[model samples]
Target: MLPFERIITIDRESKVPIYRQIAIAFINAISQGIIKANTHLPSTRDLSKLLEVHRKTIVAAYDELEAQDWVVSVPRKYVAVSAKIPNLKPKKWMDEVNESAYRALFQLPFKQIVVPKVKSNAQLPEVIIDDGFPDVRLSPIDDLLKIYRSYTSKKHSIRNATFGSAQGSLKLREVLASYLSETRGLNIEKEHLLITHGAQMSIYLAAQLLLAKGDVVVVGKPNYSKATQVFEQTGATVVEVGVDKSGLLVEEIQAICQQKAIKAIYVIPHHHYPTTVTMSIERRIALLKLSQQYAFAIIEDDYDYDYHYASSPYLPLASSPHQGNIIYIGSFSKLLDPSIRIGFMVAPFNFIEQGVALRKLIDVGVDGYMQNALAELIRMGELKRHIKKAKKCYFSRRDYLDHLLQEHLKSQVSYSLPSGGMAIWIVLKKEGLVEYLVQHPQLAIRRSAIELNAFRFGFASMNETELEQAVLLLKKIIEGFELQGVKGQL
Candidate 1:
């Protein structure tokens, strides 16, 4: 008989329950062939006595083993290893397993592994100056939950509750069609829309469907990092053009078009990411004409378009009368909360059909109940009301942050108050400040996607009180550098 005492060791301090620990030890022994299949396991009472554990713990562990088909219990006989398990070679214990051993034993099946574009901290700080995230406190979460409860309780929900249309809840698509057409002047219907997990997923679906090897996708120099990454993953070549205060330099794009057959051109047109520069109408019109002339798709990402302050928001280029070959992506995450992963894509019905098919490959659809809840909100005009209330609140917060920045770091940083969007692009006037902020133990901020002397100050997530706290902390960090500067420090 095996030395069962030596085989099973217990650490009472371990977080794993004793029963689970016992079951795991047996499983390891069985899989390693230290205990062969069809071998009788010690009776629960004997093992409990040997291990000095409660009889109940041993019974529970045996039950666990039986449930997993690792052992079978005979009628008034004994428990034995299941005959089903194939003969596996004896292997070293867990502590002895290393990378080399793992490679020798197992195969790494994935052809490609995804690498994240940004490095996220293990945990976020309590107070955050986020990268253009919406304030969750301002989202109409209670109302949304109330509506969600109503739909799930209704008996007909069973029928509508199953896998919804691949494009998402038809109710949501219908409501969004009306809401967008009314608000953004998008001439679209449910057939032209595909609801997705979020804008990133929408962008990814568009890229996978439209781009392939040897294809070329155009983007601005200082563009949204994730969008560029998605386009590149399709094995297509990504071509960067310059961006100015007016947004993507169309002339450079036109120059690129003359040289190569451009497959798609990505633009954040309204309050562009990282830079926060809105494209002029002239550029919008020129790009539309070029797309018609050159036969390339336009991926228009109009995130946070509803929160404009300085002027009336430009209706998306897709709203144009001649709009075609444009794939428009927008997010409800900004209106609701960042955690609420609801976004939509708008294109011609034919393009939308293919997008829905591709979306099914990744996921069946977005959460049906949540999608229906949102549809209810839009139908009752509650969503619009919430947006109106939150927009005003964020507008005030944006101004409050503007005032704080001007008061505190006026000398150290230079920024243009954006016409619209959640963040202000502030360029650090002096060198080494960005690196200093990065290395600071207390500060949590993202480096800009574009390698520039700038960073985005997302004020929308922070309130006046929180903004005051953040700016003061930043002021201290900057002033420490100022003192160092006075000493002609390295």
Candidate 2:
């Protein structure tokens, strides 16, 4: 046996528990090749005496190591490092040089992989106008935590944390079935739904199942860029369809269908991204007909159907009768917070079965503990109450922003008040606004579509004070441009 004193150190002053420290020391020793596989460890009593710690502490440390499969205990015998551990020691100088030389001898055929532009490192201003993210500060987190703690502390919840179905928690699916049916008029059953990490994952799963190499997928111009990237990542070619005030031009999509076999058409009809244009009912019927004629899948991303302000929002195309070839996805990330990462996809049973299989390969399952707690929240009617409360707050912010824009920016910018969703699409009439805003360290905005002149200003995430500050700064910038007689160029 190796000397226990040489292999392990007990740091009584550290914030980490004595047992955890002991287990960490053993792990480090094993990883660094100081102890070989199947090497016996000192007895719990001896190690305890050697480290001057309690015997129970040493026992706890060994339990941890065994539980993690780092060590194993023989029947009526002492514990030893697991023999299953494969040697992974750091390579010597010659071995590393030889490996590098071996790799250099091969000519790789892989294409250049460009990094996706999901986020930027540009310095944030004092006040940021986001693209319709929810104000998580207003969420019912206290109540959620209380119920979460209650569910997880139960003895049966051990299975929930350890293993779960790839289809996600059955309870959550059942609750969502009723919830979507009641709210959005979707008549879905638990068998037709698959839970995902977020709307992004839902999009990815659909792409993997429906798209193949060189398959054509149609997306709206100025679409959700993130979803576009996800579809393209699956080796499918993404074709852009121009979007107008009435949403995607279905006539243009029909024109494309005559040219090639299209696999899918991805669209966000309700309050379309960046522009916030709702698809006309006429266009919706026309697109549905085209999908049937071409036998292509329609990936409908109804991201923010919950937060409508002007009137009751239109029910999703998936909720319609005779709805086929439609894969509808929605997310609660905006309702609660993006970090929650709860999203669901509704489709035909066969598609759902395939999606669950693919999901198992990527992630074993969604968070069972979180899904169960959310279901409880839905059952207790807390989720509905929170949405009601949040709606009122968001409506007020939207109107306040509207009033501010009309008062301060009417001459320099033009916008249509969105009937729903959390942002107003502002079209800049002058060119210098983007450059001028750069000088002001207290104002931030998101550019819309492919044009730097069009921007989206979301009010839901900011308080009224921050909103006012941002607009006032923008007004000042525009006024300075007007005085110089500078016509804003695209």
Question: Which candidate tops TM-score?
Answer: 1
lDDT string for model 2 (333-433, tens) is 88888788889999999999999999989897578888888888999999899989998899999999999999888888888888888888888887756
Report the Cα lDDT for residue 236, model 2.
93
- Poorest 10 consecutive residues of model 1 by lDDT? 94-103
TM-score, one value per model: 0.90, 0.76
Q: Which stretches of candidate 1 lie over 4 Å from their true place?
A: 11-17, 63-79, 82-86, 92-126, 447-450, 485-490
Tens digits of per-residue lDDT for model 1, 1-490: 8777766777799898999988888887887777888999999889999999999999999999999999999967999999998898876544432122344634657557477555456666544557788888878889999989988888887468565888889888988999899999988889999999999999999999899999999999877888888898899999999988999999999999899899999999999888888899999999999998899999999988898887788999889866468899999998888888999999999899999888888797568899999898889888888878877888898888888889988898888888888888888877878766655666777645334767788888888888899889888988887788889854
Runs of candidate 2 exceeding 4 Å displacement: 1-113, 116-124, 160-163, 435-441, 446-452, 479-490
* RMSD of each predicted structure: 3.1, 7.5
How far off is residue 382 in model 2, in Å?
Answer: 1.4
TM-score of 1: 0.90
| lDDT (C-alpha) at residue 116 in model 2 | 36
Full-model lDDT, candidate 1: 0.85
